[model samples]
Target: MDDGKMVRALVRAALGRALRCDPDRLPIGLKEEGGVLTLQGEVPDIAAKRRALKEAAAVAEVRRVADQLHVKPAVRMGDGAIRDHLRDALIAECAFQECAVRVRDRGTLESVRTPIGTVRGTIDVSVDDGVVTLDGSVPSLVHKRLAGALAWWIPGSRDVANALEIAPPEEDNDDQITEAIRAAHERDPLVDAVAIGVRTQSSVATLYGTATSEEQKAAAERDAWCTLGVDDVVSQIQVVPPTAPTRETRTA
Candidate 1:
């Protein structure tokens, strides 16, 4: 039968995985009565204890999470001080320069910038010893990764929880095709050698190069034709005289 003991055991098992702690090493007690679950544990830090409570709350039949968990001495930190440090660390990370996320009061997130505009969101920062938990949402995946990377660079941060979601990069009508064309041009040795200028519109590649012979002009056009997605090539190559001009003075 699924009873309180079973519920507590399940909660401990789940939280062990969530916080990446050994299940046997995690000291937790679970009690359930009247469909409510009470979680008791001595977690290394407040973050781990909170994670335990969250895991219990997600249990199939858990009505509520009574977080009676205690913080172990080894990993405890002053909540206010930790928050302030996190704020300073986040702001000081040079990689986050010009980023939309605002850090304040340690790890409390104030605002996030996005293409649409600023977003109002609450960020919870919990520190256990030196590990940091960044729980918040930004606007896109790029922002999420950026914030996580920044968090890791903080002086005392040993780990980070990146629970942010940001919008994907915008889609432009011709961006992919244009990028592919550029990549192809970059890979070709002839494109680099001849001091050629290539511009593409509607899959048609226009190549302008300084060619001194018909052979050089043909070779340049052929290079443009071979590039994938280049449906047509308009050669605007100027083939100047290969030999230098000689000045002549006539004597009467």
Candidate 2:
């Protein structure tokens, strides 16, 4: 019809194709004017809302994306079903094989010993009003984070409260903690370990160097914070564009 209408139509078509899965369940509306897209509608969960905005932004000529998508549970799931689904999902993931998932009532508490260390604490999962709370202790911070992420992946999970604590490990000096942080950065595929430098002092780890993007910088800091003996993490990493010239290569 008109230029604005045509742009809206193109963005809508692209979003429809991107959200092919459960299109009926996820209903989204779009408005585009002057290359800006505004998304409005209800999505099944946070992931679907993010996907809608991301797809709209990917459309050609789209300058900016405004997200007005609401999160509504497509299907009301009982606590038991949510628990079973979360447990199965965690078990299916290779990273969480060692951790066990237990579903409990909102007020109930349970304790279990972790297989990694002789750490005895609670690893309980409870659901209330579609909010999942992961409360307990784990031998390592990785397991604690994994539990929270797995809970979020479950359907009908509106929010997650990860209160899992890391059990005390044998005391390690600052040098050992620094090496562990370095090794962690190297192991993560998203982080450029060569560009990151890790240092630890009095159980506090500091990350210094350049990262390709903000996400990479955050990941490097997260890896450092997740290290066993790290009490805190200070991120001094700078985000540098790949095309930016280095100081050594720049000529006056």
> How many clashes in each candidate?
8, 1
Which lDDT tens digits does candidate 1 get at residues 1-252?
A: 567777767777897897887877767777788988876756554345555666778789688877566555433345555556656655554433444444444545555332234333334456655555666554433334445444443444434555554344434223333343344444334444336666778756677767767765665664454333344567897876557545553332
User: Tens digits of per-residue lDDT for model 2 on 92-140?
Assistant: 6555545554557455554322447432444677777666677766665
Collision pairs in model 2: 122-136
Each prediction's Cα lDDT score? 0.55, 0.67
lDDT value for candidate 1? Answer: 0.55
C-alpha lDDT of residue 8 in model 1: 69
Output the number of the lDDT-best candidate.
2
How high is the lDDT of residue 21 in model 2?
54
Query: Which pairs clash in model 1?
Result: 83-106, 84-106, 87-106, 139-166, 139-167, 140-166, 140-167, 141-166
Stretches of candidate 1 exceeding 4 Å from the true structure = 9-26, 33-40, 45-75, 100-139, 142-165, 168-252
